[model samples]
Target: MACRRLGGVPWLFLILAWLPALCAAQTRAPYIPASPDVVLQQVPPTTDPRVRRFEQLRLDLQRHPHDAKRAVTLAQAYVDYARSTGDARFLGRAMAVIDPWMRRPLPPIPVALVHATVQQSRHFFKASRQELTTILAREPNNAQAWLTLATVAMVQGDMDEANRACVKLANTGGDFMGMICTASLRMLTGRAPQAYALLGLVEDPGPKAPPEIRAWIEGLMADTAMRLDRAALAEQHFKQALQWTPGDNFLLADYADFLLDEQRPRDVLALLQGDSASDTSFLRQVYAETALGLPQAKADAAAMAARFAAMDARGSHVFQREQAGFALHVQHDAPRALALAQQNWTVQRAPQDVRIYLEAALAADQPAAAQPALDFVQRTHLSDPSIDRLVARLRSDAMAQAAPRAKP
Candidate 1:
């Protein structure tokens, strides 16, 4: 029995592609392949049947570069591949496949949609929204466009816009997809307990359901559980999701975060040690390594610095959140971290973004700087123990700073 959470539209392909872009340089040493089938790169080896099919698609597209249908198909495959493995590098491949269409003033609906998906994957929210808007203006009933638009809005902290898009999605797609979409927004807006109950009643999708969709539902449940402070339940949900798609980068990073929060740094290391190609996983490994006082943390931090430098050269601001964390924890630069966090807040207002902003403000002794985040918390009624504790600390610090000091 398929659970009526988010029906149809094959959202599995687009969901994780919405994760923050965190590609990093590969640091593994080069090795010669001893066997013809040996794979030197990629999360799953090319020997996997799926990868073989993808390669064949790529070859076909290469032979017919001007084939719009073939280009869209392959680009969609690349997006799915990136979501499955948490590898943003595949996004570039997707872009290359769609580049021919994008150069034109107005590409076809399918090309524009895929292009917008890739843009979102790279954190180009404004560009993505513009593309989605163009598509919707032409075809208002485009369920995928509405869903993608809603996501871009949510990421940017525009709850009103997101809700509007969700309503449209429900009307166009189905109640289930709308419910799942709205439930996610509610999870972030202080109604997590309710969202958890609503989703729990949803029966798991049957064997016919796509694995990515199964993973997405389980991951959403896990995240909602975490917001409600149900750590044990959250862990179970995370594990279940991983069973469906173990190599999902966003899932691994999120689980690593849970482990870190529980003070199980060793477990985080065990989970993310071999996944440094993704900056998200790489940063988590640094956090775990630092917690355990491992010698390798220093070298990893240096590598992260180099990666950030490269990102800066490219003028990319997508990883500002991760960069802020590294600056604070790994580089021990509180002021720099605070600046990055503040700048990042201007782009993303997710709970994690707000928490980092609060943390950076506190570390920099700039309680005044945290007012925006504090206001956001109060306004949204966001539920998270960690965020609440940070709020309390900031309030306490502000009071201490304001109290009259006795004359010495």
Candidate 2:
């Protein structure tokens, strides 16, 4: 999930899979630069209140560059903007805004939170968790700290720690956050139906809930419903989420994926029109074009490849999952896809991650290579019809290969 800025305050919600870790220890490395030449779409001047407020904050930060409070505020706003727009440049911009305190051993809590948010965005999971831990040790009742810790733990597949952090968050009057956090973990642990119902309880079609929170909950419900193979329910939740927060890149990408899976490539094309700034969105467009055998598929594929190459040149492997999927499905490089998927599995074990690993392994004709994902599925009790079918096919293929050739 992406962070959101509301009423000049920034709040984070664990939306989807976990972020990656740049390293176990923090370093003052140069920021990974995104491609400057890639232009997705141009936006005209906006009169939106939120945009106006963010601009004011930017002006304030620019005027008071040395002011820690202003810097953190602007950085948080940037982080929120990055989450909303799926623009990598915003994340780098956030890091730049907080560079003054990057190496500080004891920055203020707000500054530290901003630093951790930047690190988390860059996939430095261990460093982000450490920053959260340090903050919690000093201010034990910090709701944001607890929420961030829970998010980091969930991403790392440390459910026990995540659940404990959720408990702490709930104790700090974050009942709604706690419910969503724990429910998300439950869904991953094969309690999809229960998770869906629990989220419904939190979002009972009431006007009392914040639109942002409702949108996030509906998105999660949509995901869980999809896992349960309730296509209609999933579509309903997806549409409802969009109604609440229109033009959300994450929602659009998720819906595009659902459309792609349903073989409605044209629907995906229409859904993601003019939304290519984000790597994920562009990747989905590539998938749709490839599926429909459109000429633009080649150009889109080349553009994505160049983007990934830029990430590589900067030594940023934070997008292993997306890269692996691209390699496997579009590039048709099964071995490379398997390698990337394996690397990705070490960081996140979400169902999407597992599916990629399994798909890559199968395509590579390396059933043994898929054991880790299969084991994860068994251990977590994760159930997806597509994943199960793939597992069964792999098993049957293995059996056939091992069977004796009597008439040879």
Candidate 3:
């Protein structure tokens, strides 16, 4: 997904999906089944042409491992699978597939791009940015390279850099891809309504539109709708996107979060059933179970705690935001949660990052610690009712406490 943001059309040359945070659970020690029939993993058989093509590519790459073209193609496929499934194990595989070319001082352009993509997928933003910079310096009009660079900048909270990259993308003659990227930027920077309206044009690009494009647009629309507090519309868009890509872990996790906010934990349970292999999905499931007061919530929380411990042991900071959430919501350790959230906020400034930081600040009764999130909301004018409520309460509490202290 890092390599592909929104599907490119013609001149744009395939732009695809947003890169999601990788699940750190993939770093756990390998589990060996006592018997082959024990079924450690299960995927329903599929006759899907893409899956068949991927299988063929896998075989071809196996036979010709040194073929850079086949290797890049297969690695891209693996990255796509990692994004859709929320299973980062595929990302490691992708990196390994391209390792041969990575050793080169100047790998082939295609290999360089895919390598950058895998690095971005793994949250190595600086490395990915450097790789993309090198590629763009060599080929300025490369649409894919430009779009990927924009994604990296956006995720890193460098909106100006992202806009510059998007401008470069538009100059490369891919109006549609550039438009989508720009709309995404606007949605994140206080123009959700306008971005939502702009996306309507691509909402129904007829049957000719690729599933990936349609699904990506719908997901974006759904998020914008959520920001605007149009809950029903958001749910509809989320459902439509899921119909397009049923196994998309990003969609499932997002929709599940929406359901939880709507106080429909039962719906989350139904939505995320059998999809907790990834940390994101599993965390959502834990939230749902907590909401329902299910008996299994305790065990699940402990299991999740173990996973976070493993991640910390590996010195992996990519999942700090998620770990903060687990600490606050599941462990109810407000102080620790606030600490983690503050640390994560130093890395990225996404809306969710702000939300968790504010929530943890509130829970820990540390109103002053919430100043960064407060400043972000004021600067961005981000419109989210839930976040607004938290901000309002935090401000009120801070005022009340300050008043008492002043009187004393």
C-alpha root-mean-square deviation, each candidate = 7.6, 7.4, 7.1
- Candidate 3 C-alpha lDDT tens digits along 1-408: 111211112112211111112343365656678887896665524675656777899899989978999998988988888888777667767776777777777788998898788778767688789889999999999999999999888877788899999999988947777788888888888898888987886688678987878999999999999988899999999999999998787788888888988999999888988466778888888988888899999999888889888777655676888889889988999999999999887777777888899999999999989998898888767667788899999999889878855554
- Residue-level lDDT tens digits of model 2 in 23-127: 412545655558877755565237766667778988988788778888888788777767767775666567667766654666778878876776677677876
The true-versus-predicted C-alpha distance at residue 155 of model 3, in Å, is 1.9
TM agreement with the true structure for every prediction: 0.87, 0.85, 0.87
Candidate 2 achieves a global lDDT of: 0.79
Off by over 4 Å in 3: 1-53, 404-408
Candidates ranked by lDDT: 1, 3, 2
Q: Model 1 compared with the native: what TM-score?
A: 0.87
lDDT: the better of candidates 1 and 2 = 1
lDDT of each: 0.82, 0.79, 0.81
Candidate 1: worst-modelled 10 consecutive residues by lDDT = 1-10
Instruction: Write the number of the candidate with greater TM-score, choosing between 1 and 2.
Output: 1
* lDDT of model 1, residue 405: 100
Backbone clashes, each candidate: 0, 2, 7
Residue 8 displacement (Å), model 2: 28
> Candidate 1 local accuracy as lDDT?
0.82
Off by more than 4 A, model 1: 1-44, 62-65, 404-408
Tens-place lDDT per residue, model 1, 159-198, is 8899999999999998777887888889888899878876
